[model samples]
Target: MLLGLAGNSCIGHILRCFRAKTHSSFTSPINSFQFSRSIYCATMASAAAGETRTEPVYFSDTYLFSFDKASVLKAEKLEGDSNDYAVVTDQTIMHPQGGGQPSDQGEITTSVDGTDVVFQVKQVSKAKDSQEIKHIGCFSSGSAELLPVGQTVKMTINEDMRRLHARLHSAGHLLDTALNRLNASDLIPSKGYHFADGPYVEYIGNVANEERDKLMASMNEVLSDLVKENIATQITVGDSGERIVSIAGLPCPCGGTHVKSTAEIGPMKVTRMKKNKKNMKMSYSLESS
Candidate 1:
């Protein structure tokens, strides 16, 4: 079954950000692609020698970096189900859905001796370890090419998809900040919260209907100001340590990419509000001009 975004509200925003970019902009990197291929080969050889390292898992970390296109080492497809899959590259620019975020969508292309052979990518997932990662793509019916183990391949993510998911994920952070501030100023204690996909965000606690309205209005007002979204230095802490990134007046620990400014979010509208158990649910959507 296709994973639903119902209870997983926080990831909804990420899906939106990544779903908006154009894939064509990610042509093979400009410098000699062969150099990247050599690096990929070398990396694979090292891994074969039993050197183990943590693969950087977020696409945002490497999306903007230009490297020899061949740096990505292809791995064998260890396992897969119908919808989810696992694939390992010498390195990757795809972010899996973990830590309350969604995964990415893109294609992996393999060339045989400088000639394009096959291209396909339906969905991506991470394996339990870096060594046995697999990428699952939906191939056209009766397609002949099968991605054999050790085949030299070039992988590219749908750039627009990454951008959209990033935007929504960042916006969700802003929403959390808004809720925290409103609750604090009003003397309401927040009990729980989640930012549903698209614009539906909810915070659970002892907040009155009037307070919810006020909070929404205040957030909209802040959005109107179009504050800039800055990349604060990433501070990684122990699992129990406090992590914080402030956008507008909100601060929290966030390990996701965001737009440079809030104004880029365009206009936001709160469409629905309700209560679930002791928690409140607020649904919203972005207004496109």
Candidate 2:
């Protein structure tokens, strides 16, 4: 859908500025593709580590909560998703959804003497300019006027929610591993729906119902056994500059928070698998022990 402005080109730019699709009331694969791709591109091109830019703390420590103090840089009013404000900090521990994982939900607080001022982070994301990461939420005081630039804040993430997200995302990678183990690397991974409602990894291939059922059972068993094996999850930067997440030696391009080891993912289950015309959507879930 080519969205062009009839009166002025500036209007199109303004529309793009408010990237939230809430007002559009249109939901299509094409629109979703563009939105998710835009986030991916921003995540990839963001400020690199240790180069005089706000560092993505999750890149180094995903388990970190109550992260060290960070100076507030900018606060942009990002309307939509509850009239949230995009807070840019000198550094962040909240992981934005990228490369097929959901974003972290958390809060950041600043203290004065003994009094604490809090900011609830409803969503985390990177600005399209790739300059800084945005912790999108509203101030605890119900007004953005309280959050000012240069103020230092302490960050805290929702550990339980973050862990669940890690498990789900790791499950997605495990599913991809299962595909490769079956010599089905030809099923290129295109996108992923990692949120809790109905998470699945979309691949570019049509699979028969019978084959998908067998896959569900077999992959579930493998993931379960792998978790029992207690294989640690390792992360490293790729030659092409993508953050690679690997488990039991199988690697995948990912830029999202994850558990430290396969053991941390309590119990794995293959919940659903369905065909989307030409795409195969493999769904799964994690059971907490």
- Number of the top TM-score candidate: 2
Report how far residue 17 has shifted in candidate 2, in Å: 33
- lDDT (C-alpha) at residue 242 in model 2: 41
lDDT, candidate 1, 101-220, per-residue tens: 455667666555455544355655543323323455643321223344455455567776666665555565555545444444322212213224544444444457776677667776
Q: Cα RMSD (Å) per model?
A: 10.2, 11.8
Candidate 1 off by > 4 Å: 1-54, 57-86, 127-134, 139-152, 180-197, 226-245
Per-residue C-alpha lDDT of model 2 across residues 215-246, encoded as one tens digit per residue: 77877777777888887776654344444456
Best by lDDT: 2
Give the Cα lDDT of each candidate: 0.44, 0.63
